[model samples]
Target: MLLRQLEYLVALARERHFARAAEACHVSQPALSEGLRKLEDELKVLLVRRGRAYEGLTPEGERIVRRAQRLLADRDALREEATALRTGLSGTLRIGSVPTASGAVSLLTDPFCAAHPLASVQLRTDLRAEEVLRRVRDFEIDAGITYTPDSTEGVRTHPLYEERYVLLTGASEEPAAHPNVTRPNATRPNATWAEAAELPLCLLEPGMQGRRTLDEVFTGLGLAPRPRVETDSVASLFAHVRTGRWASVVPYAWLHVFGVPPGMRALPLVGPVHGAPIVLVLADRRPGPVMARALLEVARRTDAATVLERLP
Candidate 1:
């Protein structure tokens, strides 16, 4: 019935614990419980089904929680905009990103920070494309960076870059690393999909979006890469490849940021260049949040793909 009630509900849904939700709402357990009761009575519906401890929300509660999240986001955005008119934007700007694109999130956040000194940025790097979209829909994050999503119904997308994959391997024996790659020509340093498959590789978990794309490339070429290590962390992939015994297929952005790690080689994987378009996704709400709009503007003006043309 009240915004305070809605806040309590959203916090409960997020924390899934009565005491924690109360703590998040900055109120005592009794006050939060009383507010929820009044909200339920006014709506004449059982929002949460409880049994001593905190039980999950009811079906109706689930629907209301979604709407509550949006309403709260709008309320906060309204306040932010009014404040911005006088003092500039203040509040956290949340952005979610897929792991591969995580290294490059700075491409967006750096500029946003420079423009809005009163705001802070929270960059969540563990999201998958689905989770990013989901969080955006639920207003958990202001925007997302991911490979061009398959569906773009209620969201707006700005293409940041086309992700290019590269093979990261140790340079311990490079001038003649493989019979195929005698030396990496700076202008056209390349290795074929088949050549990459032949190496002892370390890769992301199969469940990851980037790993799936890599699998498709190998499958298309009639080659299957058997990685010696599998991890969810990109840093782990780089570390394994650093051992000289394992090679990895990673986004060229990593090379752009850290530059071939030391004693390593980053060769553009060709013979089939699989490129994925990474983008910024914002919810398509009417009069979207001011911070999100500003971020989208920054993204549109950015040449996020420019680094690919001139990287190690």
Candidate 2:
């Protein structure tokens, strides 16, 4: 019934193990379990499925957990509203961002923190589009940096910028590298998504939104890329490409943050596959006073033009 109980429940759901969840909440396992029991008793519903080990939440338990998450979010918003009214501003802001956009995460945080030095920021780099929406709805994260499939409901988006896919290859003229091509920009040995798909490629894991988009583009062209390697980290992807044998598809903006190695050249994916837009998404629900204003300020500064100009 109390917000603290709901907080414990959320942590438990995230961690899946009672002891670890309790540790995260800075409480003993017994205390955390007792709180959850009391919450179930108050609501008159079973909120957890207990066995020899933690199994999972019951159907009703799952429902309650979702509601509890929203309730806690509302509570935090109320407190933020009151505090902002009393003082100028001060509170924690949690941000979730897709792995690709993780590079640009600081673009919003740096300025926001500079203006409101008292506020704290919690950043989560490993996020999917659906996960971002769920956290934002539950008030877990204040906002997110994600790409568009525009599938998530109950969220508003602010366009950050469009991203063009680029090929990354090593510096040396290794024969192992794909043969050089004469495009408008032929100084670099590069190919379009269709062209690259013909050769061995390194790509992100399939589930990631970035990979999905790349796949869609490749599939649309009736081409299936043969990946020599796959991974979750952009750094690792570039590192592999730097070796000269592998090449990867990356957003142009990424080249700016993780600079292309001296031996590497980034050629834009042209011909059939152009690019896609990235966005900053936030919950449609009102935020706490301090966080609400801060969220708007972030959205204001991260407009399409600002981000586009920074793209490689």
Candidate 3:
């Protein structure tokens, strides 16, 4: 059983088409087919279902595919370990992050890169919490930055910060235009959840975990927010809030990073100060890849709480 044959089998399972799988593996279709046939003969098990078109993998093939994924991950980890031993840590550390955690990821990566000058980082911020966990479990990402308490069964988590919600409003708004606020005092820097819910709002879409947390908080407070604009992108929300007519409730850390976006003001959301713990999650494998281990070490030493507190 050559590793190349296992690679072909895994590719076929992923693509579900022999021709596409062969293309993915960068080999001719006949060569890939012959490799699979040899693998089946050596293992004494029928791996692929024979047909004119590409049939799905057999039951035994499914089992082997799972094993193949682990084997490939371990092989890569071994290579990373060897490289680290020879000359410091040096590899691409892939990270998946939920939208709300995007602002905080640099807290980990910036220091990691500074320490290991040869190491590189790739950060993907479009993932939901579930998708982050899935990618980490599948070895697609080295780690993730996501919210806590959504079932982290096969992963280890390092708590980075607690994401607190805030009410953001346009700083230059007229008194009459802000009819939602009964108080209407520019001096009052804090807004209750009920008060913030009364404005024409732009919020994250309901499918996102950050939005779900907001929904839960609103439901608990007996306030249902009907946002005028909904988006999945935090940058879009920020842009809309900068228009001087729309308001939003978002993580306070965002304001810390982007610095109130010129004409916007972020007020503490009162009456139900809810916070979600954001964490760095990695697969629960002992002696993980060197890059992952080095990144975690940086995360461990980061004073994220102090940095957030000192943010204006």
Candidate 4:
């Protein structure tokens, strides 16, 4: 049918509410319903199961929605391809990043924008690894910065940097303050994972990717961090550490731009772990969108690790 009809279907799938889907499509509820009805009639299938409210899509509807997503993606790619040929790279580069890599994502985008001045970036740093991969495959985002496994089937990855962990804490006054290793003397000052776990901590919520990484490392060392405060925001973690009441284990990259929060210290977490490889992952579609491939190229050529490692 029409591309407009496909857009309506995709919006419906995403929103799952007739009124909300209509709102997303920027059309009235009646118009959205009429468009879907026309699409179903043209395809000769019962696409949606309707009730008092917006019921779920049929099996056939789900398949068609998947195809619809791809069709819309291809349409957008064609337009972007044409624009790139006329000018240089243009349009917004939509990037989804795992929370742990959020602070370091600018390391990739800053250079990307400088090189292609016409191209803008839309950065979403509030996604998990699985969600980032899912959006990439669905053509929802142009690229993602994440800590990935060795291989993901339909995604192409470029290793951007290795994320090292550090213990962020207040001034060392108390007896159990992980042995006040001064920043000047120790060079790369370090604290054992056990020492970090013993402190009253404020950590990311259990569901967050960064928290899970810390949890895995702690588990490996037979240590479980029972945080006094749990948060979904990295900023909040820093706030708690600044209070001198809570300590946290965080990616060292986070301190590159802002440095450790005032009245706090960042010590490398020592023992039983290598750094996490943060990578740029995107869908592996052949002749993928020009914008996505361009981002991957930026990742390949960029020295994000060097910049992220340079603490303020």
For each candidate in the order shown, give its overall lDDT on alpha carbons.
Answer: 0.86, 0.77, 0.86, 0.83
Total clashes in model 2, counting residue pairs 3 or more apart in sequence or in different chains = 1
What lDDT score goes with residue 61 in model 3?
94
**10 residues in a row with least lDDT, candidate 4:** 177-186
Per TM-score, what order, best first? 4, 1, 3, 2
**Candidate 1 residue-wise lDDT, 1-312, digit = tens:** 499999999999989999999999999999999999999998899999898999999999999998999889999889989989989987899999989989899888898999899999988998777899988888989999998888898788888888999988777655432345443344556888887887777899998898998899899889987876899888889888776767889998877567888878888889888899898999989779999988998887778788566775
Can you write out model 2's per-residue Cα lDDT over 143-208, one digit (the tens) per residue? Answer: 878887456576777777777778776555445444663222346544676667765578998998
Residue-level lDDT of model 3, residues 17-127, one tens digit each, is 999999999999999999999999989999999899888989999999878877888899999999989998888999999998898788888899899999899999999
What are the RMSD figures for all models against the true structure?
2.8, 2.9, 2.5, 2.9
| lDDT string, candidate 4, 1-312, tens digits | 489998999898888899999999999999999999999999999888899998899999999988888889989999999999999889999999987888888777888899899999998998977888888877789888888754587788888888898888776554433354222223446778887888878899898777888888889889887886898777788887777767888888888655866678888777854588888887787789998888877788888888776674
TM-score, candidate 4, is 0.92
- Mark the regions of model 3 whose C-alpha exceeds 4 Å error after superposition: 12-23, 46-59, 175-184
Instruction: Judging by lDDT, tell me the better candidate of 2 and 4.
Output: 4
After superposing candidate 2 on the true structure, give the runs of residues whose Cα lies further than 4 Å from its correct spot.
177-190, 287-289, 310-312
TM-score of each predicted structure versus truth: 0.91, 0.88, 0.90, 0.92
- As for lDDT, the candidate ahead, 1 or 2, is 1
- The clash count of every prediction, one per candidate, is 0, 1, 0, 0
